[model samples]
Target chain A: MAAEHADSGFNIFPMDQFVIRPLFGNHGMTWYTPTNQALWMGIAIVAVVLLLVIGTRGRALVPSRTQSIAEVFYGFTYKMIEDINGKAGLKYFPVIMTLFTFVVFANILGLLPYSFTVTSQAAVTVFLALAVFLSVTIIGLVKNGPGFLKVFWISSAPLPLRPILAIIEVISYFVRPVSHSIRLMGNMMAGHAVIMVFAGFAGALGIFAVFPVVAIMAVYGLEVIVAFIQAYVFAILTVIYMNDALHPGGH
Target chain B: MASEQLMAGAGQIGEHAEGMPQLDFANYPNQWFWLVVTLLVLYVVISRIALPRIASVLAERQGAIARDIEQAETLKRQAVEAEEAYKKALADARAEAGRIVAEAKADIQKELDIATEAAEAEIAAKSNESELRIAEIRKGALDSIEAVARDTAGEIVKAIMPVAADQKAIDAAVTAKLKG
Candidate 1:
């Protein structure tokens, strides 16, 4: 198991599990080859279906535990979008729920043993962030026309500082996706790596491995909370960004 | 052989440490494909089923609440109206009772006045009849006394001077005395 990592001092290859390997024998990965990443992604999807869809199939007047959970999750995302975007903003509630559940499921499933952290990977987050950024830009332009530019134009500032502020605003607007993607990916990757580092120490310490083991348990519990928070933060930010699209020009 | 195996392993790790696994382009299409598929599935399921059901339930609850409030308002108004009707009926009944009492008092007062007048006339008629009866009794008593006195005088005369002499004279004397 330590064969993959070169020993500067320790042979703990934390990054090895993140590698994309073919599900079949040692064959080359064609586009169709089901990699570990794809398998986990599918599993996350199935988990979402079972938990949300089938669990709430009863649609009872008085909800069971599973149904209540599904409805609560639904209402949480719905109210979040409504509060940030207003009534007009709630039109896009389905999209927001989809995005939230995607990140939420991806983050949670990735925490399992021998599982790939789909959201911790840059490619996945970048794709989602870019999609948000692009679609927001397009939708704002389409709906508000040239008035969409008014979001960057701060009218409350002194007239002389408007253009300078607009430039800063524009820069910040572009910087959104970079920060958005990096924050989630970085948090996930960092938490998992820290756990791995502890794992490596646990093996090396032998007798006092119990300390690291205990630490791992504590961190793992925290990661479960972090997983939910990151998803929530990502969803809230999406709503806030979408608000700019819905109300392009205001104080 | 072990050294050779170690060299092979080192080479493999070196190839992996060349860059991050995610940055590898070969895995991109497959990940992208599944991402698209899963997102579509989630979107369809959430949009078509779960959210709609919750929304309908919420709307139904809101409607029920509104209906219940409207019903309560209607009942309250009806109760107020019913109380008003009750009060009005009570006042009417009281007024009717007052009229009834007034009619009865008038009728009773008229009957009492008539009875008092009848009783006073009867007492006056009885007093007049009793005064006439006393005068008649006094006259009868005077006649009876006169008759007794005359008879007694005649009886005395017969016994002493023999005969029915001076009957008329005796009666004249008695009558004169009694009259005086």
Candidate 2:
């Protein structure tokens, strides 16, 4: 096995896969340039449509196999919002469902060989987090007016401690997007990189590659679980933030 | 030697100045643009199409189940009512049969009483007619015996009497003897 690529030189750059490049011919990257990132995002969109749109086309009372899968995704997201955000937060279910489906699809799809993870990129996750953060903030402001600041006001604390608590709350509030975005991106990138590293070991270990191969299998299984869990975490955190925004007084 | 080569590869990449591509800012816009487009498309498709269809199907199934339960309930009630009606008819028939039996008994008794009375009246009339006939036969037998006795006395007296003496006296004596 080592002799397979021995002539090409012993090179295994795990980070090389993370490099963003144009999907087409080499050129200066532009904001609107269709990159591999865009291509993978497009694939994720297609996956979502196939599940949510085409899968449910029958609208059968007794669902088809694909339709049942589609409904499970729908019901799972619906219940997630309702449980964490409560009935009032149900109004924002579609947007949160979008975030969930996109992240989940990207995470799982990236597990395929030669596929780029859209969520593995900080820029994409940041955009997603910012969208949730911005929309929830504006919704709070518009729905609750000046009262939305109550989320940080900490009225339950002792009068003197209230000011300090409020400051802490405000800082934590602003830091939400940073942690939210990085958490997803870091998990995805770390898992993929570790798997790639193990694969490189398998390549270098030749006939004794069984050790790294087994390790890759174990990590790959763990990565599959992590992929779904990370998506769940992202969606659940979005619900919590939305809950905070919807009912700032409860903070 | 392999380890050395791997170490050199890592060090060379650190000097490449590209670092982690994720930290690179130049590709942000492309990722952001595509991400927003994908999210927007998902939101429209889900809210506009999928959610409502699922909700309607669930509601329809709920309604169908409820209707089926109602129909079954109605059928059960009708069955119960029919059973009650059948029981009532059965009871009525039993009572009707009992009344018919009593009426027949009464009619038979009345006819038996009338026939018994007629037989008794006929028996009484036959006995009265037989008694009248026996009384008339006894009276006739007594009259014959008296006539024979009177004739025998008169013969004896005529032979004995030699004297043609007083027919009037003889007649008076015979009448007086028979009377005595």
Best by TM-score: 1
lDDT of 1 at A239: 88
Tens digits of per-residue lDDT for model 2 on A1-251? 33544556544567767877777866555567787778888899889888888887887877899888988887898888887778998888878878898899999999999999988999988888888899889999999999999998877778899889888998999999999999999999998889887887788778988998999899999999999999999999999999878999685
- Give TM-scores for every candidate, taking all chains together and pairing residue i with residue i: 0.73, 0.72
- What tens digits encode model 2's per-residue C-alpha lDDT throughout B1-180? 644533333343323223477876656766788778878887887788877776676677779889999999999999999999999999999999999999999999999999999999999999999899988888788666556555555566667874654555665666667678
Model 1 lDDT at residue A192: 87
Model 2's CAPRI class? acceptable
Candidate 2: list runs displaced more than 4 Å: A1-10, A155-161, B1-19, B76-180
Q: What is the TM-score of chain B in candidate 2?
A: 0.48
Worst 10 residues of 2 chain B by lDDT: B9-18
DockQ scores for all the models shown?
A: 0.25, 0.27
Error of 1 at B61 (Å): 3.7
